[model samples]
Target: MPDHPDTVLTPSASAAGVAITPTSASARPRGRRRRRPLTRAGSLGLNVLSAVAGILIWWTLAKVGFNLPTPAAVAKQAGHLLADGTLEQDAMASLRRVLIGFCLGCAVAVPVGFLMGWYPVARALIEPWVQFFRTIPPLALIPLAVVLFGIDETPKIIVIFLAAFLACVIAAFQGVVSIDRTLINAARVLGAGDLTIFRRVVIPASMPYILVGMRIGLGSSWATVVAAELIAAQEGLGHRMQSAELYYDLPTIFVGIITIGILGLLMDRVLLMAERRLTVWQERR
Candidate 1:
């Protein structure tokens, strides 16, 4: 009998089914090469097909006189916005604010998160404040923000900060608290101090979780940007869309929606790539 599935035995009739040679057997790459894997083009085409189906449904509803515009009209409007440069300006303005606020949010959240996780006293003191803020929607603070900071970039950026900060804090805190105690014990057994244990074991173990939290926070920040800009803003994709709505320009509205979607997709992919590169050890896991 073979010791493992990978080992094969050649049974000889002369020996009445006695095992002859239990040798390791290797399969050829022909198995993989024979399978016709789906190409990138095929995957893209499927996505395009789905989009066309959605547009067709939208067009049908529009022709039957629903509120939405047809696909062609929206495409034409997108082209016009591209040529006029309004789209570029507004999108950039919104992106700049989100980036600035996201940076501030992560900077504050990470340290606080670490503190809350590492120290019980800090957790008891800080967790309540985090919970209180997290419960409040980013939009609810708009009026207070406007009153406090006025209708300027400051207020808008503050809104973004609120959205991003609350997200990251909780994530980092949870990551640290959830670390395996066994790892800590192992490090201590090896003569590591508290600082060494935290620095070498706890931080690395918690990083994957902390990074995931930031990714979520980034999305929240972007979503909150438009809401932040919606209130008394001079320029931004959200502001532009709101302004278009006032004029009842459906095509312009479509362009704003699509622009936001595309930009969000791009940013998310960049974050995902960064996370993948930084956490390659997790992959080999």
Candidate 2:
């Protein structure tokens, strides 16, 4: 094809001592490309804004008309409780119960869940019972636990243990069953024995699910402990809240609730970090 009259060309070397190039896609000066907004800063700022908004709403409702205490009142009450050592006592008591119960639950659930998943006979014998118990809320067993173990720390711990155990068992069971068969078969081809394959492949692959179950179990333990404390005993946040309710001590109640939420959030964050560390080899979206 011949160049048309409208076609423009530039000389490589000109008499004017300038080397010119054709105006083409490669020759154009690019405009300043827009940078992406910083997501972390935006997210943190948004979270702070949301918290401030929630505080304002709470303040308005409490200050303007509601019978509830304002955030300021709650803060004052929290300060008093802190100074008097009541908050520390209650928080420690609750923490103790949750940790003990959660540990017990995980200790039992993980092994039982793995067994049930690995063996059909175990699954057949236990699955029915697991399903039945899981259907019943942990709170419902409080009366039975109290009757069997007495109203002391035993009953409270038992209820929390049950709450954690059932949830964790299911999670672990699912994790075991979801393991890839190819890995197990490959191990077998490489002369790995059953025990070796299970130890090296099954356990590692199922660890993420176990951690997930532990997180769920931890939450359940906290909830059950609170309910157990409400029913019978002293020194836990639940007990404190229950006592406060008798005198309409709204600020104390708010403090206890907030403390539980904060503790739960912190524990969940720790568990999430653990899961990420353990599952580092697994592909993520």
Candidate 3:
């Protein structure tokens, strides 16, 4: 006869013809786990509640003469801006600059960071400069960037690039260097060449950090672009906000601030989804 399921059962087993049913290792007793996953409805309801609470708080503060604009006023302003096409134009301009700078920065940062982590000589040579540059705020370079490239697309893009590059380089470097030496040794034992090991072992293991770096870089790029646009720009969200501030158009300022936050959050969500998809091998906590 084939092996009985109960044959391998631990601790408790009934006699052979007793019609014993085996308990699965995966099965858990009721209420044993600390928390249950939130349902879709529950999550949506919670988000809606939070939004309502925020609006209420803002309204109360405005009523108490805190000189703050109410949520309703901000929403109305957002609607007007949307209707006038000003918000859309500014959003597109900002998005273009950020995407270009972010792509360029990551293109350079990843390879340099990977090399630095992989080779001791590369690390010794490049790490000091990276550390030094990282210490300098991206905004602090605005003066030099303007002097060199002028208040043009070049300067704006360069500032954004610097912000992204500095953030991502460190992340990628740490990711690569933090890898399990044992894994690399095992790959070597299996006759994997340096390039092969990097491809098959290092990249996959370090991808989490790379993606994390990119996410941070994205946030930095957005923030730096705002500061860059503040310097000199024809059309961008930051430029719009600066223009609004001069006129004391609190509603428009609020619109710009909210729009940037929403866009950043959406982009972050996209990156998180990508990370989950790519790192399916990683265990979830």
Q: After superposition, how far is residue 154 of candidate 2 from its true place, in Å?
A: 0.7
Q: What is the per-residue lDDT of model 1 for residues 54-95, given as tens digits with 9 covering 90 to 100? A: 888988999998898888999898888889998889999999
Per-candidate TM equals: 0.81, 0.83, 0.86
Query: Pairs clashing in candidate 3?
Result: none
Q: Using TM-score, give the best candidate's number.
A: 3
Clash count per candidate = 0, 0, 0
Off by over 4 Å in 1: 1-49, 283-285
Ranking by lDDT: 3, 2, 1
As a whole number from 0 to 100, the lDDT of residue 101 in candidate 1 is 94
Question: Of the pair 1 and 3, which is ahead by TM-score?
Answer: 3
TM-score of 1: 0.81
lDDT, model 2: 0.89
lDDT of 1 at 209: 82
RMSD of each: 6.5, 10.1, 5.1
lDDT of 3 by residue, 24-51 (tens): 5555477676778888799989989998
